[model samples]
Target: MPHRTIELHVDRDSVAMGDDVVSHAGVLSAPRGTLLSAALELASPEIRSPGWSWVAVVDGATTAVWSVDHGVQLLVADRKLTRGPVDVFFRYFVQIDPAWLFDRLAHGVRADRRALEEEYAPIAREKYRAELRRRERELDGRFLSTECVDTLQHFGAEITLHADVACDFTHDGDAWSVRRADTMFQVFRGGGGPIASIRPHALGEAWLVGMLGASARTAAGRADLPDAEPLPGLELTASGGRWMSRGATVVQVRSELAARVAQLAYGRSVADLRALLDA
Candidate 1:
């Protein structure tokens, strides 16, 4: 589905200041963001007036109602079906209460508020991103002096011998080097045209995935709740009123692997890194 963006609009003609902006429409461009948010009750927001009779504009056009309550009676379609006394109408929805009472006012307010997200969404996303950045910066401090060999081994380089059939390997101080993987192919095939080669980084996706696969430890502790979402890297077995949290999945990275991962980007430049890393 294509993502639809909604903007709150306080009708300059209807949702006016002091319940009257017809006399002063030009002087006051009806507030749309924070100032408009302060007008609604925080818990149960509603339009102060029932004069919000305008249909919703989707991508800048009037949208037809698809359904109301998803039931048989509500499937009826007609503008007069939603009519209230003297131009009071429901452009978006009609919320009938549990006792079958028409709760038109609340849902009417919800139309634009839901569109604008009550104007609270802007500040909420800002705070969330700021906090995440702060925690990331603090976590990256552990990798300033981390050893590359140790970090590489955390992703699996210690026991992994760089063994390719055509390439002669050399290991010195836990670091391996090679001239080219296609050297033997060139000598045998008598040097073909310009060639392409692919050698994934020493510690790459396979190594990261292997670390996860080999870490299933089967924890001894049991969970108090029998029904609960499984934790990452954990399996659950429900027996008598409690759940056994098996598969602890202890990834034995020297506690600093993530920090080192952050450090590895020390010199790279990426515009949208979203972290304290220079990249």
Candidate 2:
């Protein structure tokens, strides 16, 4: 059975404020008449409030089928495309209306309450409850921040490819792997604070190695951090592998925190890493 491989590319790694469209190009390599499906996931650092949507355009035709799942927006397209190139454009727009603010605010308050109940312990619950109440009171007059609005505007896209044939398709790359790689690199690159610890399963060790390798390459360019010794500590044992921090405060490495760590470790710049991945 033959397998298929798809390579994804973005026209610009980063865009300015006025830029409305970002071009995406993908090359699909498969046998002739092979049917395949492609989906693009667009995600932002912050959650969108309301009256905002993302649009996808292909061959000058705007896509009508789009959906959001767990804060990540997706656009899917299927075709009986042979080995060829694919192109698309993504646009994001938002409209704010004061009349709709109250409804959004009510939803946000409910969400906060649910999060507090699910995430906090009984002993610490009241403190957060009070804080939420205070925030609710403040929200009565407060407006959204420019920084918040700007963050909602910025987003990243990941392309996923799937084949319709009953053939074996294997790819080591995924959005989660990319995200983990970026996180691990940041912990090793070091600037603000290193990760408290990382507990990787047996299979996760390979990903950890790749991320460490990228961090090693990045560290070579820095004069201050000459070695990888001062970064987080990694130990491999029969049970699994662990990356530990030297500080008293222990911060578990998660996706969101990893993104923040990358930002800090890379001096608030991720364009180089993104370009490398895109290439």
The lDDT of each candidate is 0.26, 0.31
Colliding pairs, model 1: 47-109, 218-247
Would you estimate the TM-scores of all the predictions?
Answer: 0.16, 0.23
Worst 10 residues of 2 by lDDT: 161-170
Report the error of model 2 at residue 275, Å: 58
Residue-level lDDT tens digits of model 1 in 1-279? 422322232222334347453331121122233221221111111343231223332224332222222211121122221111111122433222211212232244333535433344465546545654555445443211123334334434442222222111122232322222332111011133312111232222222222222221112132211222222332334344332232222111222322132223222222112122111
Task: Evaluate model 2: give its lDDT.
Answer: 0.31
- Which ranges of candidate 1 are over 4 A from the true structure? 1-126, 138-279
Question: Over 4 Å off in model 2, which ranges?
Answer: 1-3, 6-37, 42-52, 64-77, 95-279
lDDT measured at residue 89 in model 2 versus the true structure, 0 to 100: 47
